[model samples]
Target: MTDENARHAEKMKKIKAARDRMMETKTEEKGLIMVHTGPGKGKSSSGFGMIMRCIAHGMPSAVVQFIKGNWDTGEKTFLRERFADEVRFFVSGEGFTWEVQDREKDIAAAKRGWEIAKEQILDPEIAFVLLDEINIALRYDYLDIDEVVEFLLYQKPRMTHVCLTGRNAKPELIEAADLVTEYTLVKHPFRDGVKAQKGVEF
Candidate 1:
């Protein structure tokens, strides 16, 4: 082989060895509390991707949408249609706060959603639970943050993974999370007079 190819192979071999060593140290496996937050899009989308992964592995999963209305979303439709027995989906929001424009109603909706989420989280049959847009509810003080955090950290099943998705996640929730991802918005088509399109938004 050429000198360049020989060097490249040796470098890759070293990288693989280092990666294996690092992986060996990560032996503990437990359900994680994952948070997806920030101003950029794809927070809920990422949570849905994890739900898909759970479904692919034949694990039961549940979703409780806290802020998004019952608009027909692609992921929702596909999961319900294809994996009805394996997935439990609930749209618990009346609408977005700006659209609803009623503080009392919004609070009621959030509480109802939280009840549904709690039920799913505690279900022994469910291995994954996605609390979609729940951070927004907590941010607006529609739900008690302390109570939610306590239940998530202490009351949820030991092997059930929970994912919370929204823009402004609470500090306490972040501290309790095993994994946190924040999306940063560099640019968006909405700034360029583009409307929310099907299969992209919703």
Candidate 2:
């Protein structure tokens, strides 16, 4: 073979070897915990997208809403109809903290919501659990950070994936997570008084 052809053949062999190694190391099924946090929109939306993907793959999922109580986004409504059995939503029912005007009440509602979220965590059959707005809950001391970390470490169910979404997620939660996504807010139309439109930011 020509020198140039020999080099190309050597590169092809290396590529095949790498591909074989990857295939050998690949797992058929695995579970992990992921956190999406930062001062940007679409955290919950991203979680919901993964939930849909899991549903497409016939995996069960559950969602627990911490801060959002009465604000039913379009995604929630759609999932209720399409993936009702695979999804669950636990709302605080207290609305926004400022709107509620009661710090203690917000914490109480958050604790109540965490009860349901914890239940979902223990469900081994549910392949995924999205803790929506949990960062804010932990930031405001609405949920116990140490307890949450312990649950993630020791109480995680077998073959269960978890996704926690909100701004400023707790450091402990990030440390315990297998994957973390921090969304940076550059600019949003909401700054220009644009309302959250359905099928977009809902």
Q: What is the TM-score of each candidate against the true structure?
A: 0.96, 0.84
Model 1 C-alpha lDDT per residue in residues 64-180, reported as the tens digit of each score: 988876567888788889888989988888777898898998999999999999999998999999999999999999999999999999999888999999998999999999999
Tens digits of per-residue lDDT, candidate 2, 11-34, equal 999999999999998766757889
**Model 2, CA-based lDDT:** 0.84
Global lDDT of model 1:
0.91
Scored against the true structure, residue 180 in model 1 reaches a CA lDDT of 97
Prediction-by-prediction clash tally:
0, 0
Where is model 1 more than 4 Å wrong at Cα? none
At residue 42, candidate 2 shows an lDDT of: 83
Residue 174 local lDDT, model 2: 91
